[model samples]
Target: MSQINKKWYQGMFSNEDWWAAWLGLFFFGLGLLSIWGLDAVGWIAKPKTWEFSNLIHDFSWSKLLKVSSKNYHHLHPLASLFITYFVFLILTSIGAYFQKLNVKKYIIGFTVIFFLTWLTWIIGHEAHLSAANATVKGHNYYQEYNLSWGLQLGGGASFILALIIGLIIGNFFKGFANKIKEAAKPEWFIKAAIVLLGIKLGIMSMKAMGFTKELALAGAAAAFVAYLLFWPIVYFIGRKYFGLNRDSAAVLSSGISICGVSASIATAGAIKAKPVIPIAVSTLILVFAMFELIVLPPLYTNLAPNQPIVNGAAMGMTVKTDGADAAAGAILDQLMISKHLKKTGEHWEEDWILSAAILTKVWIDIFIGIWSFILAYVWIKKVDRGNIKEKIPLSEIWFRLPKFVMAYILVWLIYLGIMYFFPDIIGAAKSGAHIAQGPYRKLLFMLTFLSIGIITDFSKLKGMGKLAILYAVALFAVIAPIAYFVAYLFHHGMMPPVVAK
Candidate 1:
């Protein structure tokens, strides 16, 4: 079986990327069955806020398995935890087997990682840890903390904790980190989560289709315009200002301009630059992206207190990695929603702010394929000053394209179609969609945080201080500000829909 001779459909069975699509849609299909009251995915464990005193006072095996979402059947906490572990283990193990990983080790490693993630999730959910003045079911929870500093980190606290643990393991407990490496697949986890996010978007569109359309258009436009300005400016800085070679400048330009690792690799291949250039640039991109993930959520919330949607869309544009961007968006969503709820005493819809950020980055991700191809053609035709007749592979676009996007769009369109033909069922459908997109989606996100931390070693960033400086300057001086302004132009005054009174 020569590589080029493989059929397109073969990807379904072999490619981890395609497996992401399949797994996403699989859960999404179960969610859709919710319209008929199937309640399939609703059994997934969802952590609840608990203080140590309260937990000890009211401890029970049953209490541990509280179902987080309303309008669904409940399970014992132990049952929920075990079922979640069993389900994910089986599904991910299947993927590992097909991907030719050591399934036994992967299963053992994944079990450890999953439990650790859940532990962090549970601890982070402690009212003092995650809660703010945010409304849950229309009542302000922050009133209870009137005299105390509530941490108010929202769900982001869990993510930060998970990453910190992973980083500790990765940097200090290298042996254990290496053992878990087989299961620390952040991209795979996040991609699958992106698929479930489709369900969230689909449900949102059913309720607010017009807003969804407006957001999609704005996101696409913002990304396109940002890319146009970003590439050339960064390229010039790298070449003329930093005194780098053409190839290094081009690779650095795409790495910073587009979607981090993918963009760097794509541009490196496009310009036929040495593999080492992209590899180094990718490391730099990852470390700096982590810095942004930590800094931006708080900064954006403080700076743009009333502009949640704008901040989110801007985050999508500003953060480089999908993992970091989406993670930041999730944190920002929680933080801004909490702040807004505290201010207005109204419940803002969940996920819309996060979606705005993710959607904008998604647009950039989708464009990177086409952008890379153009770069390839430009390099062959002009940059290299070589033969204009040299062939550029159109297949590169498909290879670079984010397959999880198809799952997102598919669920959204299906929900929209249901809304069009059967308006009465929209309510029923939303409950089902919640199972797919709610706790299950969150589990995958937690996995992304831990995996990202496991892979990030700050020590590796030591020798690349100059590259880090360039990334920082490009980010704060150019990327962050312009991305914010452009996002503001498109998304200003656009707010996530509030829950109806």
Candidate 2:
């Protein structure tokens, strides 16, 4: 009987969550058609690495373009890039239109952001800036310049570059930043990417079914235990130290404990907190999430070089926002993988570490929905006894549920089924799967990084420094250590499956 219950299906079409599903599945379906030898989605523009010196010395206009990996080699690189841009423009524009945003601004802004993202992508992959120690065994770039400072940052260097560029624009050119904020929807981009990630997981799961099961079960358990331990301690801090009201404490607790902005907003609504509480907390969470994004990857890599899965799962638990968390996980994935490959001469599988992070975050995202409902009921019946007659809509759970997760799960199940039932076509399926999971997914992630930087305005946290301080302290003092231990408890000794050379 509540308003939250009224639009259970609205997220299906009205929110970024469904848009991610629709967009992801559109390409996934194209990949699915590849079983019949059709490369329906192969024309998407994918970038390749080139040295800055080479690019400067002998750069042709064509140097920047490449066809989507091996699967879509038939397509022209330039055409693929344009076609990919057009598809994303239309899809994201539609989402903006329905969300009651300035559609015209979104399209133009997205265009600028898109090109800027590609520019950063190309620059990021410059051999000196992004290369690892030639993990694939073809080239030994490590020996090129004595391997002293080749960055060795991998693709993550580019992502960080994009984020830095966006941050510069966001902080220094605030007005211009606001104009493009309509298209700076990092959460939307990341969710869409997460859906595509499901395809990757499915393909990877097929390769090592036991590994997937162990990683997933461990992630779920870690998330569950982390949530149980996190909320109360954070709630106590907000109440005892910060002297926050119950609603504020609950929202802050969820923001820090659960999946960041989503949890903060969900808790606020459930507890009937003033909207400003969540809004303020969401801002704090976003800014701090960036802080975590920037700091956690290298920190975790140094702290636990051997425990790749643990570091990743810990990233999922430590970083608050989905965009920041996933982004951090991705950076950590690249960092740890590159480091391990260089040190051990073994190419540790790429997405498994990322999957550990995302899977844990997904579990937390799923749990937050149920947790919000329980909180609502408790608040109504126990805390506010006068409102005991009021029924909490079961729809709140549906509303809070992350829809991209649904898309991710669905894609994973469908792909896993294909692998199980029609094993013969898996090779064909893999061709399309690579396109879906690699180039397409990377595009979304690049966009996410840029957008996240664009929208994050650290100066806005000026008036709320105390809350920010509290969040930072709690994150470092309480959250990070506990999360690491819990993740290590379940995921220790878990080595990512190595890729075949």
Candidate 3:
């Protein structure tokens, strides 16, 4: 085999090629079953009321069946997004195959695509908005359709569903690949994956309004410091105290410290953290994040009503999943709007506030790429190079570097500047007839979720392996959180609050 082909064969899609196991699909089916089983057991039941912000008065199938666009079903708006699960993975894998680039080169390559799309978005807001999710609500069946109402119901639900479904399918396919023989995977695939993930994450951060340079510095500094300190502490408890290795601790710490559990694992993988570490780390982060997602929204609502930006940022940073962060943010925005509803009609202001929070979280996520780079550099310099007396040039950190993410970072910065400076132009452009450009965010998220799902296969997630559960738990869960908290305390509070209100 050619050296390039040889190298590609040992990649992640290669290393963990066993995921074609339908693990994701099975679980998705199981999740449905569990929901059903709960209903059957009377533990949980279908919602009796299908209220649409009190605006959707009619409960008839006809009312719900009203389609918006030819392709989009207003009745089941979620169905469109749900379809992306299959589409996103199939498309991305195809993109990869055709691009035929290695992971490193792929990351470098996406820099170009992300930039062009970003530029197109910058210049073509109207086209963007038209493609977005929106609606014409009817008050008393005579009034125009409620624009916000349609999106909140159809757009949001569908976007979320796409990610969930994507995860299921991606994981299932991955698992099946694992059980099968000689399944091929490309390592550089993650580079492309992360590059796309970064773009989405960067967009989310750009969405956060109050993510000023000073604030970003504070958040990044805090996040980095928190991961550095807290992760090691958790590592000690789990490793020296609980018996785990550096690689395992690295995975858990990375997951908690970054955007989502899966993204964290990918970061760990790029840096070559142990194989099992990413999986274990992601699981731990998910458990904790899910807890926060379910619990923290209400607390923030009651505790920090005036501080939507603060609460939102905290939630994004604290919550492990993008969905949790979004849900928490929306909840906060709604509460703020409700509080102001009686006196002010500035309900839409919450969107901006939520945007601010997402932007901050995205900024923190971007830092993960930087952190991975730093780790790689240090590993090559200190660990790989050994003592200073016997040291080679530390410049080899350049080689260990994942340079492609830099392009993504640069494009995001440029887009952020453009969008911020010309919100009016962009807004008008995005004000498409059917929906606003906001739907673009939804699209980006679906793609991101599907991408994540396609890359993960828990079938290979054996708790015991050359690198075992304890190790991964120690690295991803313990070490990363310790560092994150330490950084957080020094920089600010749990989150950076928006002062716009």
Candidate 4:
């Protein structure tokens, strides 16, 4: 029989895939069942209290100024978590050195690990353990997630660590693991991130973001207005000032108006827009993601300690990339954690601003996939400008679209269900009595990252390099400042608007 004639299931999965799928399902089922059983027992309520006698109960200048987030006594355990990621990274590096394990296996392993974690920590535990003690004391749950010892991914660190290991293997074995190259795929990471976000939301309250019905409506209006107004100006600057061509300009403008460069690059690529366009756009995103990830958290905390939502929303609007958007959110949360209830007392409502910021961005990301399709339609039809006729059928256009986006949309929809369907599932337990539910879009992101490293040649990413670098830098320049400005205008310099508070 011809390939197209094969059954859909057979066409998608080979025997090898079947075995992998079964094993994954088996383990995942066990984890979910175990967690649900715990919920059924209802035995894990927040302990009335944990005994921490050394607790200073203060957010002092000395406490905030220290290299760490903790006072001296609470320092030992906090150091261990950082050390664990550090050691885990080193082990991955050593394994890459001694073993010939493929990236696909590791990627699959990470996916499995993350899945079980989602079932256990998120769906299973309600992501409440870290905050269990504090929640009783009336602290917000964003602080809960951070303190929870799970659900924290920021700074591109894990991705960066993976890159280093991949690079080392690439140098020694030189394509030994080349065949397993799905690690660089951005779409897979995006999908996984969204799923986790949705699951995370299930356990948390959305009211904390101050996303009032009125504020949400107002944000939508401002968002569309900003897109219409600024997109053209951004396009002009790229075309006239930066000397970018039509394709490059489209990618830049899309990154600005819609998501960020990742969205820009993927959309640009799908339409067969110029390769240089995405390269420049991705480079710009990397630069700014780094800046916003590392710098903005501290800067915001220092400058206007109380103004995280304003700052975080601004970053999300401007930074563009979903990952960077979350990183900025984490920063805002951390800063809030460092702030105190009273100037002399412990910080209150820690992570509130950051969580709110992330939710705002999450809401914004819902539009990204839709907006990209619209732009692609606009480019192909109205902006064809030549031999490209406007006569293509809607079916043809639909076929031309990337299938991966369907995966993303499906994931997003599932998350929406988790969030709205049974908010109560999160409030109570996870067993059948309470009820519940929720990859790398990865082959592509691995390719994208390897493409960057190989092209960067593993050297310092200083100075201009190629189409990618210029595009990436331009993206960051456009995104970061705009975020700052927007946040300022909306919240008025961190004074805490009625809606935000």
Best by TM-score: 2
Window of ten residues with lowest summed lDDT in model 1: 1-10
- Candidate 2 lDDT: 0.87
Ten-residue segment with the worst summed lDDT in candidate 3? 40-49
| Candidate 2 structure, TM-score to reference | 0.96
Candidate 4 ranges beyond 4 A from true positions = 1-193, 206-222, 269-271, 340-351, 380-382, 387-427, 430-478, 488-501
lDDT of 3 at 347: 35
Best by lDDT: 2
Could you tell me every candidate's TM-score relative to the true structure? 0.94, 0.96, 0.50, 0.55
Ranking by lDDT: 2, 1, 4, 3
What is the per-residue lDDT of model 1 for residues 1-501, given as tens digits with 9 covering 90 to 100? 433413445566666777888888888888788778777777787886655556688786543446644543555677778888999999999999887789999998899999999888888877677776655764444565342657767677888889788879888988988899899988788888888988788777877788999999999999999999999999888777777899988888888888998899989988899999999999999888888888999899999888888999999999988888888898888888777766676667889989999899889889998998999988888778754468886787887787887777787788878888998888888887787888889999999888888887778788886677777788889899999989999998898888843
Error of 4 at 250 (Å): 1.7
lDDT of each: 0.83, 0.87, 0.41, 0.43
Model 4 lDDT tens row, 35-92: 3433221111111111121124542322211211111233343243334234333433
The list of candidate 1 runs beyond 4 A from truth reads 1-7, 68-74, 138-149, 387-389
Please give the clash total of every predicted structure, in order.
Answer: 1, 0, 73, 22
lDDT tens digits, residues 221-337, model 3? 555554556445654664565555666655655565566565565556545666665765665554455445446656765665555555555565666655445544544554454
